[model samples]
Target: MGPASVRPAVLVDFGSTFTKVRVVDLRDGSLLASGQAATTTDTALEDGYAAARRSLDPPWDTARPELVKATSSAGGGLRMIAIGLTPSLTVEAARRAALGAGARLIATYSYELTTADVAEICALEPGIVLLAGGADGGNRTAVVHNAGLLAGSAYTGTVILAGNRNAADEAAALLAAAGKGCAVTANVMPRVGELVVAGCRDAIRREFVRRITASHLFRDAAFPVRMPTPMAVLKGLAVVSDGIAGVEPGLGTVLAVDIGGATTDVHSVGAATRRAGVVYTGLEEPHGKRTVEGDLGLRSNATGIVARVAEDPGLATRCGIDDLDRLTAASRQLAAHRSTVPATADQYTVDAQLATAATALAVGRHVGHLTVQHGVTGPVRIQEGKDMRESAGLIGTGGVFRHAADPESILKGGVADERWPSSLRPVSPKFYVDREYCLFAAGLLADDHPHAAFALASRGLEAL
Candidate 1:
């Protein structure tokens, strides 16, 4: 590495609650600086962006930064509606496909016969409506029903049909004939239980692109709201894996987990692996992130954590019901409700425990409940046949890890994310989520200064 004191490029992430800034030295991969500011995107986009940008920018008097870039979940991501014939099967498949494409699933319905339901879906005003139902050899009633619903709708959004391959041509024509603008794809639930998500996933992406042009990002065009932040992250991870083993390490392999408030996302990369995916989200439930325990977020889903953990035997003992109740209550206002600074030791313990459980559950689900941990491991990289010890890296992101009181406290929080924090003690470890590190910012770092991304992620992030 040349001069370690070189200026660094910055990555900025504007979330609903916090706007994070991270800097990575491209020459040496050393993380330079990170900071956050409360975000109030709901108030107004122009104002929100102005404040967020200020929060992200280092003191003007400090060192002039290399470059500043950004991504945001503000103004809501892309929104979507999934339509299928069967409530659980095809509709579920459509939901998966939509979510994978980075669209937020707002509603799903199957077609049996429902004029009222059709009216309801139309009123949701989704950016995209994914229509899927029946198998290639199955009945057309469900698909036709959904098509009929969109026939006279005022919504001019993209409608992707991911259903029976045989009916694709007909479905396209039908939806169009019904005055619905539509895109057709093979069945998301192709063969009985088999899900052909690739086609629909592609269509969803197309729809996002089609809609992004008009979103808040562009004042002149339609914008995509409710687009899958996790989906984009997954795609970015795939890009990294492809570049790593295929480009950098030549025979690279890796595993990743993005522990979020509402969900914990897992992605893997390897030579043997052909692609990246969200292996699981709420894979380990009643054990999700503490901050987002409910559908409401820090501002809305605060009560979810308490409600979920209430069912767990672990929380009951580790954190008394009274404490649990308090945190659960506080989580709702987590975004902006600043009150009651943690004073008591027990309060601190509970706060740590709640964050800990969320992280562990997310991490565990990402790696899967490994019956054995001696497969492969590494520092910032991994290789095939390495096993758990060979996992190139275990990256942690999100606010919980970032706002941790200290590194040791973060480690304890890691233990909570994982039932056993010591599970991977022998492996090289570092965490990059401090008041100073942001993954999206680091992801920007990971793009050019991967080594630095590795370094900071190792040092600042809590290691179990």
Candidate 2:
């Protein structure tokens, strides 16, 4: 094929366990052929990419996708531990910011954290450590105290100070003076409830790039191409929504659920609307819109799923306690392993059920936070009139989601659905592919046809 007709490209979809390569014909968005193989984690990347594409694609197309890039949760991604001033205050905001930027918080510490806590943070071997405290100027002492503790810990990684802005520069200098390469960013806790993401996001990305390049583990520079699997999924979904739904689709938000072995991620996005020309009592409206609930995930927090499934009598009656423990454990393994779940009947049933429960739970929490809520024992699908479909696109992702045998199992056939209650809009579910994250074909499409990318984004968004 000539240069114009050749339009040859490479699409790399990095999953937790595997990576996929597709050779495409851009003229009509055709996936002319494809390649897929396990993520060669332990080997040099130059050879690994070569090996993965050896059989799945041809010589030229396999060499580089013209777009030889990717998204992943597999490796070279941020693994962190966050210390917050309050239990569910700054910590929560910090968590959301981390998630939005694609970093995974292995653990979160709130008030009254002790030396044992600092010792523990040092042991996690995370790529980075996020320290956020009482809102700006609110808890300067605690923030400084935590900074002091981290300065002494064995955490050789970068230390990001995201607390009282007034003390930030001093804190950064102090940490630097303490022999730690300090990273200073805007306060994660700009206020009590709202999170300010710009500064920290930049710092995290920079720290991430620096850490990967410095680590003996990443030997090859392929590390920088890694996008947080969730963030990649989020970006892909954003593209899909913009293309498919258009601007004035009357859609309020786009809701996505990624039910993993250890974490379930639910994101709700929509146009920001102010009520009565006045701000509400307890809400952070950014650009008149919002994205909520990163604390409520399925994988690492599987026990939360048990508490949720326990509350739903119908869901509870579906299985035994032994399976709950086993399932959660498997999910945790899945999160750590970061790969596809087998597509078999028995596994499929369990996967679907768990995903449904996680999605419903995450969505429930996100919606309720925008309003207000009780504990997991609360008996409500959503707060009164809170509009679950504010962002109409309902994209389902994660290992189970991409490989699940039947998505309808959780889509609620009607009111008789034993899973989620009837308040949330039942928009048709869809996916975008970041093979390592979940194979929703986002990579393949993005490789073959740039035009179709946006069209795929808006799938299933009835309200948007």
Question: Which candidate gets the maximum lDDT versus the true structure?
Answer: 2
Q: Return the lDDT, model 2, position 245.
A: 39
- TM for every model, in the order presented, reads 0.65, 0.74
Kindly report which residue stretches of model 2 are placed more than 4 angstroms away from their true locations once superposed.
1-9, 22-33, 45-48, 55-60, 111-113, 134-138, 191-194, 222-226, 243-252, 272-311, 316-344, 369-387, 413-464
> Which structure among the candidates has the greatest TM-score?
2
Per-candidate local distance difference test: 0.52, 0.57
lDDT of 2 by residue, 293-347 (tens): 3433444455566567766656644432336666666656544653444556765
Q: Candidate 2's error at 347, in angstroms?
A: 3.7
Among all windows of ten consecutive residues in candidate 2, which has the lowest summed lDDT?
455-464
